[model samples]
Target: MQAFAYVACAHKKTNLTNLLISFKDVSIRHFNTLVFEDLNFSLEKGQHWALVGNSGSGKSTFLDFIMGKASMARGEAYYPYFDQHIQEHHQDDPLFNRYKLITQVSARHEFRNLSNTSDFYYQQRFNSCDSEDADTVSTYLSSIKVVNPSGLWTIQKATEWLKLTYLLDKELIKLSNGETKRLMLAAALIKNPVLLLLDNPLNGLDVSARQDFNELIREISESGISIIMATPATEIPESITHVAVLESGKMIIQCKKYEFKPISFHTIGQIQTNQDELKQLLSATPSVVYDTIIGMEDVSIKYGDKQILDGVNWQVRQGQRWALTGHNGAGKSTLLSLINGDNPQAFANKIILFDQPKGSGESIWEIKKKIGYVSPEFFQYFPTGSTCLQVIESGFDDTLGLFRVSGKSRAETSLRWMTLLHISEFAGALIRNVPVSIQRICMLARAMVKNPSLLILDEPCLGLDVERQEQFKNLIDTICSMTDLSLIYVSHYQEEMPLSITHSLKLEQGRVV
Candidate 1:
């Protein structure tokens, strides 16, 4: 209910070491297991620290501790503030009057103090009643280009964020997951608090957006702001001068500058099979001569008159990889959804799938056997507790993995694919504990195990490093040569597109304008 209480913002610059955000004997637990305990560390101004480990290794839980969202088993957080007004008013008053404990949360879109009771959080969470404060959140969202200026504050921006995080794009009452995260940031950076904590703010953004956010963090740090961020990958910019590493509630490493040994980035791609034999396997079916596997004919999808997809016309076929580039709110994702049969009614007469008649009971689902997807929104719902091999075996079920996979041959084949992807080392590991890049490989292996006929990759390369991307490209080539798959690559950046893909279908303003 209080602004800046859960997460504080930047104040004036001070010596972070002297400023003092000290915690003593802090511990947190979940059920029987202690998530973290006996942690003590100090964060100062201009210190950047990366918290790296496997998934579910208490990273998100650690962020929760600072936000005051999690219950701590034991510990105390202390900050120092010299208040001249308190000195003059009542020298006998407790020191608590001068110092305030900063909360945990990351700041991005609108660097402002946020209150839970405000309509911004309340109305957005459960959208039946309009929050009196909806105007403020709406105004901020409008300014940041997340929503339109002249619309219902609670309804518009709230639904868009819901959609981005893979919720139903209707009323917020229908939210699916356990609380939605934002494409923007929590509004805590404006509070000017003594301590600042950021969760993993860089997880789902595109590569270009990552660079943009890094720049913003640098600007904040250079102005003498104190920041403590938890991330699996060490992305310490030159701005970060100190670090504190926490593991199992203990300070594993703390230093003025935590130097992670730079492992040499190596490219991993192999062509043990003959290129000629591989070429025959990768060839597309020569029966279809249409330049596009699918085409949109002056398609105009609208919400009333405001067209989400304008009269768009485009062509896409095998061997072509179009990045589907666009700014946020540019209707890129909307178009992809339409193609994937998620919204068939939205554009009935104007669209075609693999040259199939789109409207007459035809959908991308009819050709579902041919497509494979990797949207960030869709990927999160994928079951992750299963082993790398078990889930891969379930791909034969063609149900985004199934609960019961019993065939020994399928499991053996799945392990073979895991070996092919160089993930045999983790064949026994849980998907929930692996890194994003590894999880992606697992998913890719799942998709490729069946050798889908027309692979439709929606932002497939997300979370992959340059090495994996290269490895993936070769894998795609090998698969294409091994079977008949017409690849459809969609992304917002041209650079992320693999050089092997040569076709494109550009969508602007809903139509192919």
Candidate 2:
């Protein structure tokens, strides 16, 4: 339990004088499952590492092991530099090593209210009044207690480096997915740890932000802080010196950055879905045929003095596919919230959904029944206690979690969608227990279970591997071909979009560009 237990003198034969971390013959267990075994990895003082693998390949678990959060069944994980720090400052308190020597910016983040309680819901982000209760970005960043201030990372420097200066006054709960990612990185930098861990750091960022982030990573590496990040193979930054590829709970490949070859993704063929199940689902929830799926006219939304969307005009029609393009904080999410009936400000603007004007007698639930929605923000706040089956079933009623008991038909339909998505094996598994990629697949199945007429996917492929991304993209194309489904897809990577897209909308600073 002490930090010294993991610290040992470097082997004379290895001669790694500047080693920061070394894992030898390591075996890790999560519950009864052996998640990692015979894992050997090392990090030198100047080396930055990238952990690349498919979904559920234990990439995140590897990072957790380095952070001292994993249960090691056998072998030793030595921390030479961190041990020195512990010996110098808190020798008796080994448990504080993780807090003092390491900081991790994960893909998921949670924000609390002003009262410092996490009593918020998924829909609260769309409700302006409720969002105000959450801490502002500036407050959240300032609240971080820097353990080892090196004068290298201040709040000002972190914000400026991450291009987050304009969002300092915004509420934490109201920021987009990419904005939140930047804020989390800034918080970690301010802590000034000896090692930084990032899990899929570029998953939610737009193209420009991703480029900026890669540059920042290079700068950070030069600043003497070691970084070990779990990322897709294609996203490995040039700052990284080494690459480790994991598969099925084993480190399969380890080599220098220049020697690593990227994995090639083949063209995915059409997905074969059960036509009877699709027909039954569509018949059960017959969508009213409408020419205009969504209509917005000079719509403007503001939270206090901050303008989220300014005089934006857009429209979508039946059987049309749209690719929504915008950088972080460019009002893409806000615009989608209006169509999905999540933002309360929709009533104050001139908007239409499925031919019904905003503030009409139609209930939000009625409007939502015809629209399938998924986003990174929704995934972060989704209730995780329900099983995968239950999570998808709830989508039929457009609820966050399963409430009412589903009958035979709904259960069958949910199972059908799960099977099509290759996730039926996890039907009984709790959503929180699944890998992030599987969780995302479950959400996609949930969105498609009802066979809704309109599908709004906001960065739906954030954490998927190359194979899974191709499969999902092909599935989207197949679904569009078979049904009259209208689509509004959003992704920072243009390659992730399906071939069915027929229109594009670009937003810059809340205005159509």
Candidate 3:
């Protein structure tokens, strides 16, 4: 990978008139499942194209093919140097060598050893794995060469351009999602690939980050580099000159961005929860005055020289639902950890969960029994091969897998929740084999199966498409209206918040803002 980046940095300006990338009757497949077939497309030197699609519509697969990381089943896919550059040379002494693909999944977390294997492609997908050895921001930036030959671009200039100076000394893993993306974009720019591919570049980013990224994209386009990006229709920037929409193994529509008006995106049907039963399961006695669900006073967390949370004060009562708002790296995850009793730091802080002070001799399991949690990370690490029913049934014991035998009543409860989530058909299917969207729904069912007093959802809508996000939000609304389930919903997109969120907590740089 470093060799590829180095080659790109060393290449001279190519003829702008030549085709940069071409796909002629190309078909791509993964796990023998066809992604897209009979796709014919061509990218010019300066035109920017948006590959528009919903989740599972093969947007990422499209980009992976361009990166040479994905296999073509039947047709032809060609790159400049690898195809035309070599063919023009009579298949000898190939001159082209660089292709930069900045995917939705970060390449930062993968072991350097897997650099030669295709398995390294999506190693960072759907989860954030912390790396203590990640290089500091400045060091990371300096490693890449500035592609511009006039010595006009420098590491310092790139840092300023991306608004990443604030994280100059922070480890890559320590940066927030927004910060990480800015750095990734900068890395791509430094390599100066003739053809650049971005997969959902705006995802998990705050509004400011998106603005910064769009500006960067414009700058790259103005510099005459070819760009192919994959994003949903709603997020297609005005900079896109052309748009292509993909459906079941085909390009249903391809036209100029200005002329493309996507029909309203509405999924097949919505998932309806059992409101009456949810209400019963969520029933709780009205606390007499001081009963608290979660309380934290002057809670601070620091990892060596880094501060994660600084004197944060917050409280959750019996019936209140809260929207936790913050940019990436705002300590939202840390705060949720305190409530979920998963962090050892909770023992040193004056935090209370379920009316019991943390570290006051309350068993972790006991505290966990009263609070149900779901997060993207939870789904990523969820045990594989466990059937969807087993995943939900295990919620009864607060375990990773179904270890303890569930009673008939518990089994029935799991089945009911699965039905409400519209994943009953997959009840016997392995959770790993289920589609990502369905897997997330099953996780939600697991969180609701035990009917805990408090619900903590940390960006529960992270991977869901628009329709799935709406369905999840509607379920949350139903639970809030019918039950006394206290909720701490965390999300970067304000629009994804449910109507049940009556209160909000904002965090900025590890402090309550």
| Candidate 1 per-residue C-alpha lDDT over 214-256 given as tens digits, one digit per residue, 9 for 90 to 100 | 6656655654446677653445555655544443355555555
Q: Which candidate would rank higher by TM-score, 1 or 3? A: 3
Error of 1 at 320 (Å): 3.2
Compose the digit string of candidate 2's lDDT tens values, residues 17-103: 887878899999864567988888777778888988778989887777676666899998888877777888778775776446788
TM-score of each: 0.62, 0.93, 0.79
Residue 156, model 3, lDDT? 66
Per-residue lDDT, model 3, residue 225, is 63
Superposed by TM-score, candidate 1 places the C-alpha of residue 195 at a distance from the truth, in angstroms, of 4.8
Q: Judged by TM-score, which candidate is best?
A: 2
Q: In model 2, what lDDT does residue 274 have?
A: 66
Model 2 steric clash pairs: none
lDDT of 3 by residue, 1-513 (tens): 001000111112234357676778988875456777889877766678898765567776677677766688888766664355445533553433444222223322222211233221111321233334456777776776544444333566667887878788876545555666677876666665556677777766776777777777777777666678877677787778888776655766666676766554334555556777666555523423337998999999887777889999998898899998887778887778777766677888999887778888998788888878887545544667799899989887778789986689888878877776767898888876555567777778788777778888877776577777888899888878776779998877888899999998999988999
Cα deviation at 296, candidate 2, in Å, is 1.4
lDDT score, residue 232, model 2?
79
lDDT of each: 0.53, 0.84, 0.70
* Ranking of models by lDDT: 2, 3, 1
TM-score of candidate 2 relative to the true fold = 0.93
